[model samples]
Target: MSENQYAISEYHDADEINARLKELVGQPLHPIRRDKMEEYLRYFDTKCSRSKAMTDEAKTIIPGGVQHNLAFNYPFPLAVRKVEGAYMWDEDDNKYIDFLQAGGPTVLGSNYPPVRDKVLELVRECGPVTGLFHEFELKLAQKVQEHMPGIEMFRMLGSGTESVMAAIRAARTFTGKKKVIKVGGAYHGWSDQMVYGLHIPGTRTFEAKGIPGSASRHTQEFYPNDLGQLHRRLIANRLRGGTAAVIVEPLGPESGTRPVPFDFNQQVRELCDRFGALLIFDEVVTGFRVGMGGAQGYFGVTPDLTIFGKCITGGYPMAGGVGGRKEVMQRFAPGIGGTGERAYIGGTLSANPMSCAAGYYAIEEMERTNAAILAGRAGDRLTRGLKEIIERLGLPFVAYNQGSIVHLETGAVMLLDVRNPVKLLKELKPRKHMMEEMGAAYMSQGVVTLAGSRIYTSMADTDEIIDEALNRFETVLSSVEGIA
Candidate 1:
C-alpha cells in the first residue's frame, strides 16, 4: 500500500518515545503556573456560569455530573450546545477548537453535514430501528468489507464493550481455550475480562472494582511492546489448556500514547500463529481514523478477527462490531439451533438503519475526500508546532503523532508503569492532577483536548485552524512553571 493510503506518514520508534517518556516522568511535576491555573479556573466560574448551574443540577441526578468518561473534564465538565467541523460551543457559547473529536470517531469532524444529512433522510424514511432487518445493514457491512477485505463477515453490536465481549466469547468458543492475552494498558473497552489492566500496566484488577475475581480469571497481560514477556506468557498458557486469542490495539495502548514499533503487529501475528491462537486487533480507535483499511492495512499485517468501535458509524450511536474471516465470523451467526456451538450475541438496536446509513455514507465521504490523509497532514503540522513551542519554551514535554492521532505528553501520567511500584504509587495522584490542570488551561485558551494530552485532528482541521490551535497551545505551555 502507498504511504498516502494510511494516516500514519511514518511509524515511530517505540524505544525512543519510551525513553523520552521516562525522562518526563522522572522530573518533578511541571504543572501550569498557579496564578495561570487560578485564572483558568476563574474562566470556568465567570464565563461558564450557565454550564456550572446545569452540571451542578445534573450532579443531583447523575453521578459525577457527567455520563460519559470523556465528559469528566476538570473543574467540572462543560455542557456542549453546538458542534460543527473542527469546533464546538459550550452551553455558555464559549467557542473552542475541538481536538477531542468525540473521543476519536469524528474523523471527518463533528456533526459532519454530509453524514448527518444522510442519517436524517434514513430516520425520516424508516425510523431509527425496526428491530428487524435493514438493507443498510448489508450495505454498511459491504462498505466495510470493501476497505477491509480481511473482514470476510461482520456482526454489529451496540458498543465497543459489547463487541469485545462477543469477540472474546467467540474466541473461546471457536478455539475451545479459556485463556486470552492482551497488551497491558490497552483498553479493549470496559468489558469485565478485558478490564484486568486498566490504565497502568502490571496493575491487574486495580480498577476492576465491584467485579468478581472469576471475571478475569483467564485474562492475562504483558507490558506494551514487550514481545518476550508475551511469548513467555503464551508458553505458560500452553501448559494450562492452551491460549485462545491475543488481542491488542495495533497503534499501541491508549491510541499510541504508549506506541509500538513498526513491525509489532507482524510479530504478534507470527506469535499467534505459532501458538495456535487467534489474533484480534482492537481497532476501535484506529479503524477508519487511521485509514479505510485500518491499522492492519497500515502495518501490512492481517489478524484473524478485527474489532470496530465508535468510528464505524462516524461518531453515530450504536457503533461497534466484530469482523473477521468467514469461519470465525460464522461463529456469531444468529440462530437457535446450535446452543454450545454458537457464540450468542444480540443487541436490539445493533444495526439500526440510521446508524448503518450514517456509517455507509460517512465512509463513502471519507474515501471521496481522502479525509484520513488530510487529517494526518493537519496532525503533522500540529505536532511539529507543539514540539517547536516545547523546545523554545525549554519545557520537558513530548509531542508526536500516528497520523491524525496526536499525543502531547505534558504530564506523562500515563507513562508511569508498575515496573517501579513505589514511584508509580507516589506520583500517580500529583501527576494526574497536573494533567487535569493542563487540560483546563487549554480549554480556557479555546482548545479542547483529550485529558490535556492526546489530540485527535480531523479533516476539518485546515492549515489556519491548526495554526490558531498552535497559538493557543503555546499560550498554555508557556505558562508552565520556570518558562520565561
Candidate 2:
C-alpha cells in the first residue's frame, strides 16, 4: 500500500450529525436525586472556596474557567502562582507539595536549577524560536532514541494530541486502511478521531464539544481487560476491509485510571499481531515518567508506533512525536512528495530549539542520576506506608504503582454495586469528589498531590516529605470518615 492511494474520503452530512447530536442530548436526566446534587455542590463549595473565587475570575476570560477541560473542577481550579523543588504556592498564598507536576511533565520536580539554568543559557544565546533548524532538536532526538530503541525515526509537535493525530494519519496511510481501533476509557488525545468513548458510560459519543460524529465514524472502541471484545471488534472491522492500527495506552485506562493486569497488554499485543494491524502505545503520560524507556520498555511489548509527551519536555511546552519501523516511517520521505502526500505532519513550532534544549537536558539529568530507579523505590516506599496506615484505620483503599507512577483507589467505593450505570456513576462521582477533597486538604497541610490521580516522584521528594505526606494522609482519611 502506498500513502497516496489511502487518502481519506470526506463524509459531511449536517443532518446526520444533527440527528446524532439530538439523540445524545435527549438522553434522560441523571438519576441522582436533588438531595444528592445539593450535597455534592455544598461539599464542593465548602472545600474549594479559593478555587471557586479563582474560577469566577477566570470565567470572564477563559471558557469553562480553564483552558483545558481537565483543569476545571466542580467549583473551579486553583491558579498556581509559583513552584519550587517539590512545592507550589497557589494564588491564595497557600503552599502545597505539588504532585500534579503539570500533569506528568515535571518528572524532575518544579523549577529544578539544572534545567532552568540550561533553558536560560539557551535563551540568552539565540532566543526561543527560529524558523530555521537548531542543534538542540538533534540533541533531544538522540536522547529519546537512546532510551527508546523502537524510535528509529522521529518528529516533534506542540502537544500529545498533535502527535497522536499524526500517528493515526500515518498508520492509515501506511496500511491502506480507513478504520482505527482504540481501547475504551483510554484517552489518547483530544483530536476528533481519537475522542470517541472518552469518559464512557455517561457519554459514549465524543468526549468534548465541536468534535463531529462523522469525524469518528471510522473509529471503534473496546474495553481494556476484555480480549473477547477486542477480538470481536477487530474481526468486524477486518470483514469490512481492515483496521489500520490499534492504538492504546499499554497500561490501559489512561495510565492511572486503573492498574493494568500483567496479562492484559500482552494479550492486546497478541491480538493486534493476529489481526495484522499495527499496535500503537500512546505513552503521553507514562513516557519517561514510569521508566527510562516508558511503558513499552517496562512491559516488554514493543508496538509498531509510540506517542510521547509531558515528561519528554520536563514540564516545558514541547511534546513529542511518532516513531516506528523504518519501512512504515519511510512513507514520509521527501522523494514521494512526502510532506504533501504521506501525512501533512508539520507545525511552526515543531522541534523548536528552546523546547529541544529543555527536553535534552531533562533526559540527560534523569540518566545521570538514574532518576527512574530512584523514583520506583520512592513509589514503593510511599505505597507501602499508605497501605499500612489504611489497614490500621480499616479504610477501604488500595495503593499500588507501575514503576514511579503511584496510585491509591478507594476499594469501598469502586468495588460497590457494579450492576447499575446510574448507581455506578453516582458512587464513582462522590468517591472522585472525596479524593479531590482529600487532595485539597493535603495541600492545606503543605502536602500536594496529583489531584486524585497518580503521583510522579522526583529526586527532590526526600524521605522526610514522603513520611510527612503519609502522616497527613492518615489524618485526612480519619477526617473524611468522620464527615461521612
Clashes of each: 0, 1
What does candidate 2's lDDT look like per residue over 317-421, in tens digits?
A: 767777777777776554334354476667778778888899899989888776666666666678778879866765545565655567665422323233356
Clashing pairs in 1: none
Candidate no. 1 TM-score: 0.99
Supply the TM-score for candidate 2.
0.84
Cα-based lDDT for every prediction: 0.91, 0.69
lDDT, candidate 1, 312-422, per-residue tens: 999999889999989888888886576757988987788888888888999999999999999999999999999899999998899999999999998898899899999
Candidate 2, pairs of clashing residues: 97-448
Off by over 4 Å in 1: none
Quick one: best TM-score, which candidate? Answer: 1
